[model samples]
Target: MSELLAPALSGAAAGLGVAMPMGAMSVLLLQEAVRERRPAVAAAAGIAAVDLGYAALATALGPWVAAHVTPAEAWIRLAASAILLTIATRGLLPTRPAPPPTNASPGAGASAGPATELGTEPGPSAGAGPGPGPGSGANAGPSAGPSAGAGAGAGRTFARYVGLTAVNPTTALYFAALTTAQGAALRAGAAGAAFVTGVALASLLWQQALVALGALAGSRISPAARTWTFRLGYGLVAAYAVKIAFPLP
Candidate 1:
């Protein structure tokens, strides 16, 4: 109610404070945006969704969260950290070449590309080209390429970010602190809603800004720079995994 205004500002500040830190999840989203701007945006959306979920829980259900969430927290963090390690390991390994692009356009016949003209196997550009078929327009994405498998992967990617954020004990602690930072205002039902809403909005805005920055940076970088950046991202992610997996006792 009238008490909501000040708490809302505090909530927004808290959301921004938590989200603005550059970390594994943040780097991954940025890297994805730089490498493939469109899909990266979807990943970023997933990040925002998790932020909103956590904010809502902290603001609206803070009174009950410790009882409900604390017991499973350790196991959840371990599982999430393991997943992050696997992803990091995969990134560090030399990437196997994707088989030459296939003409997956419906009913399209085999066509010769630069490779075929030289009596060599067709390369990435062969099947990746547009086909003169119905419904297989330019908007039809390449099959078996970086852009391929995005549909199923999108859900997994979203789930991964959400899981990582949710399992992080610190995220819950941060929210808990924020909940108690104020007194009657946050405890008031309607006033608490305003604070939660502010947190969600700030989180989403920060995430969008990050993705947009990555998208812009991706376009401007050379191939070599992108490669170096990719390696750096992997390294940072691996470091985070290690930290999470072996927390100081």
Candidate 2:
């Protein structure tokens, strides 16, 4: 009983270690949905999938990697920080043409296309919530109508997020450290499985919460607020990357 308890708690704690940064992922996803009118379900799934994969893999391989790979973590952190910094800089760049709608067309069909299919929906109008419309600010660019490549681009966002998460590697290192600390308790197969399961559960719950929150926040915020939100989110994520890259003495 105590054996299982230790691992489960460790796993949950590890999963939640990035609560602040992960919250940024949520905000970014929601902002993407509202401003770009893209569906976030795929992005949310990508984020959760990476989290679960990293947790499980860390639990399984953390001990060996911790022993062998500890020295290179700094390099890994530097590379990841570079990736995050690039992403942040891009966020602060001149806004592109707003992406086409990622949702299904309003009517006339049973099998709705994937919510990520671009150019499949109608143009934004004054009454359309969240999207740039009649009330959009002077600086706010007009949202796009339809384009040939929007689907591929929408899909790429999901893959890019997965790539960014997979390359970070610090989360796995943290998991490995936690598993190393709980060696004896996790020696038992049942206890180890319990810990990994707890981790998966926590990751899933947290990611789902992000998706729900993003969906809810879509219409409530004005376009300017949405723009600043991305700036803040990107900046925060970049800061986290820097912290990972250059830990203080």
Candidate 3:
């Protein structure tokens, strides 16, 4: 039992060891969290969930999969490359236009002067414009519409995470090796379950920590800084995708 306990702890640690590295997924998640906080969190959760599933499968069926899935690795790499490229492209492109402002009520004070007057001194009657408030246009720029993209991005991120996990032959192989190495300790059913649980919990904890850190950083930065950071992050993501797609010797 003592021997079993030691191996179980080691196996859990091994799982975390494999996961804690800053891989493409980690970079993407951190960037997304900083750029779109809630969606990033959701995306991280999706990744962790998929990882748990992979770990379980690898633990339970490593030998069978190893024997039968010869070309699975290539497929996974291709899929991951494609997803990464798509995400990178989307990030590089200009953001969608801001949704049209809600029409101001006739008596409502919402109205903005012409674009030329935006930076100028406001006329006394500036409050009498067509929209809801004088500075409505100024406030409703692309930055204000993250909420619009947030939902869609969150869903896309979740799907992408799942796909990446499913197709990453390297991840599959890593789990297989990990589970096999620790299988003797995990032969005891309860110990194995505990080990797997610990790994899943650790992953969740770490990802949540990342999300919190990103949120804090986003909050502290100036809007201009945040915008630039977001652009830089996306650029890195694009570069990462390209690297994956065309690996160096």
Any idea what lDDT model 2 has? 0.61
TM-score of each: 0.73, 0.65, 0.70
TM-score of 2: 0.65
Instruction: Write model 2 residue lDDT over 1-249, tens digit each, in one string.
Output: 876786787777766674335533555565555544443555655666776776666667768868766777777778877877776666665333346545546672335355324422222233233322122222334555434245555576678667777776666677778877766666577877877777766766776576567656656765556555656776776777677778622
For residues 67-103, write the lDDT of model 1, one tens digit per residue. Answer: 5666766666677678778777766552223454465
The stretch of ten residues in a row with the least summed lDDT in candidate 2 is 129-138
Weakest ten-residue segment in model 1 by summed lDDT: 128-137
Q: Which candidate number would show the highest lDDT if scored against the true structure?
A: 1
Better of 1 and 2 by TM-score: 1
Candidate 1 CA-lDDT value: 0.65
Q: Which candidate tops TM-score?
A: 1
For residues 80-153, could you state the per-residue lDDT of candidate 3 as single tens digits?
77777776666545332334446566444234545322333222122211111112123344555755655665
Could you tell me which residue pairs clash in candidate 2? none
Error in Å for residue 234 of model 2:
2.5
Each prediction's whole-model lDDT (CA): 0.65, 0.61, 0.61
In model 2, the runs with Cα more than 4 Å from the true position are 1-10, 20-27, 33-39, 96-155, 247-249
Query: Lowest summed lDDT over 10 consecutive residues: which window, candidate 3?
Result: 127-136
